[model samples]
Target chain A: MLLEINDIHVHYGKIAALKGISLEVDEGEIVTLIGANGAGKTTTLKTISGLRPLSAGRITFDGKDISRLAGHKRVLAGIGQSPEGRGIFPGMSVADNLHMGAYARKGDLSKELAEVYELFPRLAERKGQAGGTMSGGEQQMLAIGRALMAKPKVLLLDEPSMGLAPMLVQQIFSIIEKINERGTTVLLVEQNAQQALQIAHRAYVIETGRIVKSAAAVDLLDDPEVRAAYLGGDLGEPESIAADEPAATADGPAKD
Target chain B: MKTNESTRERTNGSPTVTNGRPSFAALTPRARDLAGRLPAALRAPGLPLAFPFAVLGLVADLFRDWWGRQTGYVRWAIYGLLIVGALLLPSEQVGGFMSPYSDWAQLLFFPIGGYILLAIGLNVVVGQAGLLDLGYVAFFAIGGYTMAVFGTKFGWSFWEILVLGVLLSALSGVILGAPTLRLRGDYLAIVTLGFGEIIRIAARNTDYIGGPNGISGIPHPPTLSEWTVPESEPFTTLGLAGIAPLKYGALDGRPYYYLMLAAIVVTIIFVKRLESSRVGRAWASIREDEDAAELMGVPTFKFKLAAFAIGAAIGGAAGVIYGSQATSIIPRNYEFIISATILAAVVLGGSGNLPGVMLGAFLVAWIPERIRGLQEYRILVFGGVLVLLMIFRPEGLLPSRRRKAELAEGTGGMGSLGAEVGGPTTHAAAEVGK
Candidate 1:
């Protein structure tokens, strides 16, 4: 495994956000974590990126224990995140925003800038425009492009499809596939399970801060339980799915 | 909205003609064209009185492009000319403009020059790094006390004490900032405000520094030479006519002014260099959004602390000079109001822009002195003027382009102020808040 999360737990104040969640992403694989809202999908990514402190777990990136590393150090250590809500520097120009992604790297960044611009030609055209002025689709492109600027070994994307239109959603997923094909491993967090599973090599289903199921994307796509709960199967009856829901044992063994 | 108009003006490739509008009748055709390009708030009724300052911003913006492209030698030459002009302020003809002040040069050297230095220093923390520091005067006090203690008790030279003052203040900055900088926005401001008070109260209670009596008889810098300018015909005609000798003395404020000018220039050069480097970019990122900046690979806390240290160092240097000029230091000399005034200067003049901050400082210092005839009403008038200016131009007098955009979009540190004024916030601001 290129990246490993061994029973990592996280808390926000007194409430646990992640409860002993374990997952792995092999090099060059597109790994997706799919779940409903408030299911700890974002928290898992946050813990891996070192934004939230890991209460009881080890996050190993490139076979090195990185649980104690700072968030910025994690970026330098080759874990780049696009972050939830598409955090583009609004005051900066499209080009300047891209430059911020390569902030830790020394020397020329023209090559990286060119590659990002090539991936999103729309961004190249609007390079001088402010990031805040761009439409939702373009800003999403900029955010992803910005994360790519770090040239990370593994890119962590938190809900890349979140406010995008269906057309743009399809376009963004293709870009993610293209990114993964270009040899950078990707850990994608998404609410759109159908699309996320289509692009992902392996998928994990998380609910209430715990990973309830893990399987290959192809297998989970056909899994009836996941299909009903997330893949929009039997859309009118969420109650039928609740009966099959596991008991609330989310409060894991209290070990610091 | 303003961006679209500027873009249209560039695309049109000709001066826009306002068809004999009554509101723009007072302006010349060219002036009207420029006024039309200003933001709507600036063009509001009753804002005409402030139009000249706005025009000054437009003119500066024109030069900013050329200034950004110039070689260091050319820039230095321009700065040298400006410094020479500043130096001539002590001359009778130049100083006579501010007739209200009995000793214009003395006032310029002490409060005006001092405030400018303080504002520039504060800008690094508040403006560039987006850290609201309400206790910046603590650094100033640290610098002032360093000079007083070292110069009076140890009998140290002014140069040695000045260096020590900067180091000590920077060290204090790191000590204060290391833990507190993690607090965001208003929380940080409140902590800093308390820190400022703690410093003043600590100084007041310390018997070694004379308690409430404060330190007195702080030594002046050593005189270089007693070379007096000749009262020749050519010198008199050029308004270089002055009986002041080139030396540090009680009577002559020119030497002190010169020293202050030198310090400000050196600071400007260092700050400008830092503003263009990776360090500046890091600061901008952290200021815009700390969490995102960290995720983007910027060591946000480290850079924020760097901002504090550098800003405090400058404040300390200014304090040393200010103390030396006053020839004394007291706890009362450093007040919460002093911090507020400097912050006002930075915000009023255009927070992120250097020239704007200097102008803001100059006005903040000079206006009260200029209107001394108003007596008790002087402060009231000053407060009213600031209110009026902020009402019309919330982004500041000559805000940097990025700052202008940030304000309009209601993003970044000053977003609330912008949002309250209802500047056209984009969908991005609303989306990001989610």
Candidate 2:
């Protein structure tokens, strides 16, 4: 495994958020953790990024124990997070915001900036505009592009489509897939389960900070139990689906 | 029926209005209109001050243009001209009030230099780093005391003692900042304020630095005028108009004024460079949102401490200058109000932008001297002006566009973790930004 979490526990104060939760993300795989709000999806990503320390766990990224590393050090070690609500530096120009994302980067970023501009031409069009002035879609694009500027080995995307329109959601997910295709592994935390499972190579179902199920994305999509709880179904799972599918298979609504 | 009766009952229980009238809120806009007229009238008397300021503005603009292009030679030429002009201006005892030279220099210029330096230093800590440090005078006191102790106790030369003062103040800044700076901003401010008060109280009670009596006869910096040009005939033959030779033993304020002027200019250059570097960017990010900045890989605490240390050193350098000029240092010389005045300078000038802060320092330092006719009412008027300024333009006279936008976006550093969905958010890791 490229990124391994072994029985990591986390606490806020007196209350435990993650109770010995373990998961894995191998190289070149788009692994997703899907759950309802507060199900520890964000916490898990926070743990991986070293934003929250592990109470009782070992996180080995690239086979090196990194649970004790600092948050920014984690970024330098190649974990980038496009946080929930799109944490864009509102005070900075779009170009400056992108430059901030590459804080951990040590070399020339003209090529990287060009790549990001090519990826999201909207950012390039108004590189001088402040991040706060951008539309939600554009800000989301900036957030993702910023994370990409770090040239991360593994990108952790937290709720990348939280408030986006359906069309933008599709566009964002496709860009995420493209990002994965560019040789970076992705650990995606999402509320849109069906769509996330559709693009993910593997999926984990978390409930109230505990993992309930783990399986191949297609298998999870095809599993009746997962279908009933997360895939919006209560009956038959008729069709085997392609892994790269953007839309969930119309296996039709379950008949009670 | 019951609800209506109860409403009538409440009104019946009350006294009748002799004259029912509109509330204050209703009259607010009209009150505002009346208040608005007061400013133009109040500003009318200050119009005489405007002519000089307008000339100052024009000169500042030309210099700023040269500064932007980094035309050092032209800028230095202007500075050299200024130094010559400052040197030539006779003290009040020599020329009196009508000489177009304010004798105010002997009384006000020295302290003004100290205040400006303090403002410039505090700008690095509070404005650029977005750290609200109310006890910044603590650093200033440490700088002053460093000079006082070293100068009096060791009989050190002013030049060598200045280096120690700056180093000691920087050391104190790190000592104070490293541990407490990680606290949330308001708490940090309170701690710094407490620390400032502590330093004053400590200085007041401590016999080592001379308790409340303070240290006197701190040595002046060795003069170069006679040393370099010598009061000899060759110097007289050089015959630079309005240029007076520096004298060390005589306690002339003009030479020291030039020295302090040089100090401020050098500080401006240093701060401007730091404001453009990666560390500056890191400070910007941390000020905006610590968590987001950390995720982006800007080490917040290390940089905040760096700001404190640098600011401390600058303040210390100024303190040493003050000590040498006043030829004394006392606990009472450092006060909470001094800290507030310096902060006001940063706020009025433009926090985060150097030119604005410099302008702020000038305004803050000049306000008292210009309004000395008002005597006891002077500070009250100054307070009112600041209030009016903040009401109209809180971002200071020349606001930094970057900081203005940042403020508009909310003074960041808000962390949201835990909602059952997100968890309770111990924040044990990143909030401290260790």
Candidate 3:
């Protein structure tokens, strides 16, 4: 396995955000975690990234225990997260943001920069523009491109298609599929189940912080349970979230 | 909770009620007549534009912008000219044009220079790293005490003491930052405030470091002894004829001022470079969003501590200069008010910006002296000006584009996003942005 998250439990004060969730992503595979709001998909990714400490269980990357490591160390260990809502440094220009992504590493960024620009040509054109000024789709591209700059063996993508238009959603998924094809393992937390499953090799259905079902992506796509619950019966007309509903992301609840 | 909510509502609603009621309706005939008798110029359109300070500030800004935009040799030439101008500003003629302020202007340089360094140091902490270090004076205290104790008790040279003081101050900064950095925002502020008080009280009570009387006899920087000017006619003719016999004594304040100027120049260059480096980016990322920064592989804590340490070191350097120049020190000198004033300079000048903070330091240091005649109203007017600045330009007088954008408009793209979702994890994230 490129990454293994074993029965990890996470807490938000008295509330259990994730309850013994276990999942794995093998080399070059795309694994999707599908769930509704407050369902712990984001928490699972965060726990894997070491942003959230696990109450129980452990995560190992390439046979090394990584559960105790700090967030940036995990990035160095080849776990990069394009956090939900595209966490681009708004004050920094596009090139600087990309440079920051490569901050932990050293040596020539030209190769990586060129590769990222090739992946998203739009970004190359706006290299000098600040991150905050970009459109939702472009910012998402920057987020993904930034994560790729880490050259991670396993990429953790949390809601990459969240606020983008339907057309942009398709384009982003295609890029994710392309990224997976490029030999980097991917652990994807997404609300758009149909698209995520289409690109993923394996799918895990989580509900209220526990895995309800796990199977091949094709099997889960055809699975009636996931369709009724998260996919909302129709996979044709793209669904839109409650604007800020996804705000329930795994960042944990606001501390009072 | 219900009562508190109602109280909040009442406070918010009073402004609305007043807004709906016309001021003229509440004004009695006598009050209205008095208002009508006020000067006609006050009621004229574009009144703010015509205001003296506003006009002066506009002109100053224009000149500053022109100077700031010069490139390469031109920029260096301008800076060289300014340095020469500042160096040659004789104490004899200082502020003579403004008769009332003349007597105090010469005394202003030392404090103004000290405050500039402090403001720069604090800027790294509060502006770059976005950590509100209310206890910054602790570092200054550490620097001052080190200079005093080392110079007197140990019989160390001033230069040697300065190095030791700066290192010790940096260590103190790391000590303060390491454990309490997890505390964010107001919680962090309170802890630092307590830390400042603790340092003051500890210094007062500790006999080893010298009790309340504090260490004194801090020596001035060593002078060039037994120097003789060579018979170089060409060297003397370069407008340095008066400066031929070199002397580094601190008695005149000129040598000390030049040292302060050198320190400022080196610090400004070092800070500006650091601001654009990888660590600088990390500081900004941490400032923008700590959680997101961490997730993106930026070691937020390490970078924050680095900024704190650098800031502390700079503050300590300022103290060394201050202590050496004054030739005396007391523990009470490093009080809470000092930290607050330095922070005010950083804020008013513009946080995260070097030039702005320098300007702020100058204003904070120079303005008090200029208004010394109005001592009774100085603090009140000073506080009023700060409040007005906060209300009108919270980003500051000369805001960094990044800071201005963040304060004037809401955060872009991410908006209500805490990044992971639902913004709950955003609790500390919100604090990072500030």
lDDT of 3 by residue, B1-434 (tens): 32432343233321112332223232233233223333565433324422433333334445555565778999778778977766654334455442255443235446787898899999988888888888999998888888888887888987898899899999999999899887666677888899999999999999987789887767777775535335466434432223412355545555566677778888988999999888888888887667668877888889888988999999999888788877777788989999999989888887887888898998888776777678789878788777656543455677665663343223531222112333326532332222
TM-score of each: 0.88, 0.79, 0.82
- The DockQ of each candidate is 0.36, 0.25, 0.24
lDDT digits (tens) for residues B156-192 of candidate 1: 9999999999999999999999999876666788889
Count clashing pairs, candidate 1.
0
Q: State the TM-score for model 3.
A: 0.82
Candidate 1 overall lDDT versus native: 0.82
Instruction: Sort the candidates on DockQ, descending order.
Output: 1, 2, 3
Model 1 Cα displacement at B147 (Å)?
0.7
Per-residue alpha-carbon lDDT of model 2 for A1-256, expressed as tens digits? Answer: 9899999998876668788889999999999998765667788888898877778989999989998998889898888889866778877889999999999888899998999999999899988876755678998999999998999999999989888899999999999999999899999999788889989999998866689889999998888666665666644344423321212321112111
Ranking by TM-score: 1, 3, 2
What docking grade applies to model 2? acceptable
Give the per-residue lDDT digits (tens) of candidate 3, residues A35-132.
76667777788788887888889898999999899988998999888987677777677897898888888899899899899999999998876675
Question: What interface Cα RMSD is found for model 3?
Answer: 9.2
lDDT of 2 at B302: 89
Stretches off by above 4 angstroms in model 3 are A234-256, B1-70, B97-106, B225-251, B405-424, B427-434
Q: Candidate 1 residues A1-256, lDDT tens each?
A: 9999999988765667778899999999999999766678877887888777888989999989999999999998999999887878878889999999988887899999999999999999988877766778998999999999999999999899988899999999999999999999999999899999999999999987789999999999999888877776665676645734542122121111
Stretch of 10 with least lDDT, candidate 1 chain B: B423-432
Worst-scoring 10-residue span by lDDT in model 3 chain B: B412-421
State the lDDT of candidate 2 residue by residue for B224-275, as single tens digits: 6663334455335433233343655544556676678778878878988898
